[model samples]
Target: MKTKFSFLTLLFIVSSFVIAQDIQELKIDSKVNDVTVFLDGAQVTRKKTVDVPTGITNIVFVNLSPYIDSKSIQVKVKGKVMVQSVSQQRNYMNNQPDLAEAEKLHAEIFELRKQLKLAQTYLTITRKELDFLNDNRIISGRNNELSITNLKETSAFYGERLKALKLKEIKQEDDINQLEKKIQQLENQRNQLSDNRGFPTGEIVIKIESKTNSKSEFELSYLVTNAGWFPSYDIRAKNISEPVEILYKANVHQDTKVDWENVKIRFSSSDPNVSGVMPSLNPYYISYNYRPSNYGRIISEVSGFIYDNKGEPLPGASVSVEGTTIGTVADINGHYSLMLPAGSNRLKISFIGYSSKTVDANQPLINIALNESAQELGEVSFRDVEATSISDALQGRIAGLDISRSRNKKNIADKESIAVPFVQTENQTTVEFEISVPYSLKSDKKTYAVEMVDYSLPANYQYFCIPKVDKDAFLLANITDWSKYNFLEGEANIFFEETYIGKTILDVRNAGDTLQVSLGRDKNVVVQRELLKDKTSRQFIGTKKEVSRAWEINVKNNKSQKISMVILDQVPVSKNEEIEIEIKDLSGAKMNNDTGELKWEFELNPAKEKTFNLNYLVKYPKSRTLYIE
Candidate 1:
């Protein structure tokens, strides 16, 4: 504020501006520490050259802060050189705003203190009056009537006191509101005053100044278009970046004056070199190259299906691929095109809010149908069960043999329902099934038409189900019908493929241990006394010579325990002739070919009894070569 030219000096300056080109007045007001130039009010930029007339023009100045907008400032000066040489300093005391808010709050608190004083006085008087009534001194008129009069007086005092308290509270609230408004005003002021000081963002303001002979005119065509974005917001990891494309679905017009109909106009992103529009129908694919910078062209595609766990298709269910930029609403048929990648090698499919699933899509087609996971029931298969018996109790488990029959109620019926009969081996392993009548309809003494569809099955299992009837046709018809298998109750023995857990197995002899045994093509082996559901599953592809079918233990206390053992066997018939076992252990064991079992007892002081394992080779014709894949 030190430098100033008198009004008389300004008259001299006016005379000095003899030509219109002379700048008669020059002034500057700045909110930043230094200001050597001026920019457009909204632009916040410095122009290369600003034509000035021979006079003092009221050029407004502004402050700069990151959080504030520019505000106008006023100053007075007298010469071009003075204006050019002058650097105005600008400052804003941000802390002073809190001072304003504090002042308002202080005033509000003062008013509140006055109201609180009045309220306190009222409350004191009310309490004193209530105490007087409690002493019954305020009684009058009749007994009850006097009591009512005292209550009336007490209530009136209390009501007045409460109202006064409420009024004081309301005043406090008003004070808080005033403080809030003051704080808000301070914020607004700060925001209104901030600017970048001097920096350039990508926002461009093109003020078109046209000269029709000396008549200079200007117009603005503001464009806030993105300079770095490729416009395509859809990109999947599997998609390679090309010139990413975006479709402006909204209707676009040229200008306010005219409406263009069906104009096939194109819009460019940052660079005019890259541009695209919606493709016309039936055009050959044109190759578009992408210019790579820090950002890559984002692109995408999506495939999947929705289904319920019951093998039923869920219609119109939403399915999505996680982490994939591509998405599609499921079709009316409940199928979705998750054309995200060529395929998500690790395909994760999900419905709305349901648990998502990840499955490997290693097939030619990667469309996966999702099913809700289910909890299985507690039950098992009986054929997979070792028949309960004393012999069953002592059997270490059997390898394989012809048969030693056990007691079972075999019933004859009008129609013979065929089934495979199962028996346990010495190890308590439910192994073999003698298929005397591979398929037969039979009724038990109780008239129960029961039939075991499988001739053999696994030993250790957690759950099992079987068709009531053994007819293959009926079984196939009811495969998914839910009524085929009457699931037997009880934890299964052969519970897992190679290991069993979370399930109980009555492995009287640790038969619950997963038996991963490989059977030779024509070897007769007793697998399990009762099978899981399919005894054929107990069979395996042998990469090594099969375990010897027969094992023997010397009954000398170390080896023998004449434990009552029931053995089951299986013989792959290469010849039409019957297969028999040649035993060398204890003589008490009996063999029954019809049932494919061997059972007996031998005495052992841990000595006289001996245990043995048996194996046999099946002979076939030279021309009868079996081919297996």
Candidate 2:
């Protein structure tokens, strides 16, 4: 019985050893480096497949990047397999087999050292023999020579011996020098390896249990520091009559030491590196009657309801005192309460798909309205451009746009609610873009333009010329319900009538529901501004000075098409209370007295011209000299 037990124990030990040795290493491939990097952090996923035996298995991935966040390591298995445990540890001892080349170099160094020592020993021996021959010179040390023949023979023999010893020493020294040079090269290689590794190798160890013996594929994903991506876009418009094209792109950068090759990539707008859980909110009771010793330090609580422009209740609206963390969300009835410090009367309210609103909190029943965000853009489409550069496209395209599967799905609930069964919805907090084409990104930091979404929408075109500042007419496209398009503040490239006009900025930060994009200057509409010196004069009346000026503007439509146009000019404004100003002549133009702005809107037929005049008078004390135009 004892012998049988020993045999069984031996078998079990062998099996365990075999199981531990059954490790499979996978190579990272199909990497999407165009990551959707949030304000902070990046994520990378790698997919690999390996055939595993039907039982317990230990998989060891070696030589991974050291910058990997161990806590972010995740292992997913496909097929009938169960993951047991996943762990990551640093290998300071440099156990990676791939470094065998470095080890081989070190071995060569060792051999070279041995050879160098041998050569050195030989060199020393040759030097010693040369020294002995020189010290024991027959002609200098001893006086035993009698005849000239004997002296010459003895001298020749010693001379030959000295020459041979010198040659031998030279050969040994040359060999030693060559060996030392080779050793130096090996040491340099080792130093480079240390620099590349930074410290030691990082290895990820995964243990899995298989229910049945079948081939399975595994995907290993982890978050790595020093790798992230940012959002970039390209907007192009062929003409004001056509819809604008916006290409959403990502600029990804990484120095994690791992190359993510042509793999499936997903960009996340939300940062995984940030805290996922909301901060704990402790209970607080409002005490209106209690004030701190200093009245200035008194605090207060304000509650209010949030509504939309149509007077509809807005649930989930976030209300907080401006610049303070104290806040709350509106309930189903759009009612919210917030505790604020004294003198903080400012309140800020925000909701998804709506413009944020800020108002004073002086009224307890503060009712506010939040305008809806930009309207959803049209389907992605493309247009041709004479300029082929990405930078040129971004500079020329229309600034806002999107079309996605999420937008196509009807009855899609708010991203905050629970998802319906058998339905897949995108996360509201993050934006996902799947490029239709295959793209590659490098570890080096650089921006590559990828086509994201194209949009087609109706545009209302109008010609506007500010003759006061510029003589050229600029085409403007007024797009209503612009809030429906999910446009962020970015640059736009403008093209008019298949021509590359110029570039402008699409600033949605403070835009209203209507978006006005300016196309480049149009020289076809000629404008001329001339000062009428004959109609200008200055006079002094009873210690007071009166200055008068007059100007004329002429606009000519030189294009074949009849166009509606607006001409803008300004009158001088005075700040001194003692000065009196008057608009002597406006030619029926609309004038803003507060701003001293004059605007004329009219339709001009082809090959037709219109003229307008502006005259202003300024009166000030004659005692004080003043410059007026």
lDDT for each residue of candidate 2 in 1-629, tens digit (9 for 90 to 100): 99999999999999989867665444323333333333234565555677766667777666665666666565666767767677676667663334777888889999999999999998988898888888878564455545888788888999899889888888888899899999998997886675455445556666766666688776665656545444434455665446765554444444555555544444444456446677896765668897543334233556778888989777656565554323456777888766555446687776644777788676667788899764222112111222132222112323222344223221211221111111111343444444333334454322233334455657776799887788889887777886654554444556666677655656555568778777768888899988999989999999789999999999998887787788888887778898989888988899887898888999898899999998988889988988775
* Model 1 weakest 10-residue run by lDDT: 470-479
User: Evaluated with lDDT, which candidate comes out highest?
Assistant: 2
Whole-model Cα lDDT of every candidate shown, in order:
0.29, 0.63
Clashes of 1: 71
* Candidate 1 per-residue lDDT over residues 1-629, each given as its tens digit: 22355766777777777644432332322211111110000111121123344333323232222111112212222223122221222233321235455566556656656665665566566566556545664435455554667788877876786576566656655665665566556554544333111111111111111122122111111111100111111111111111211111101111111111211112111121222465575644545685433332222333445665655454434333333322233454556543333323344444421355666544434455655542212211111112342222233445643433333434323333322243322223223222232122111111112233321221211111111111010000001211111121111222111232121211122112232111111111111222122211112223312211233322222322222222323323223433223333333445665653544333334334344443433332333443211
Off by over 4 Å in 2: 1-41, 47-221, 225-256, 268-427, 436-446, 574-576, 625-629
My TM-score estimates for the predictions, one after another, are 0.18, 0.49
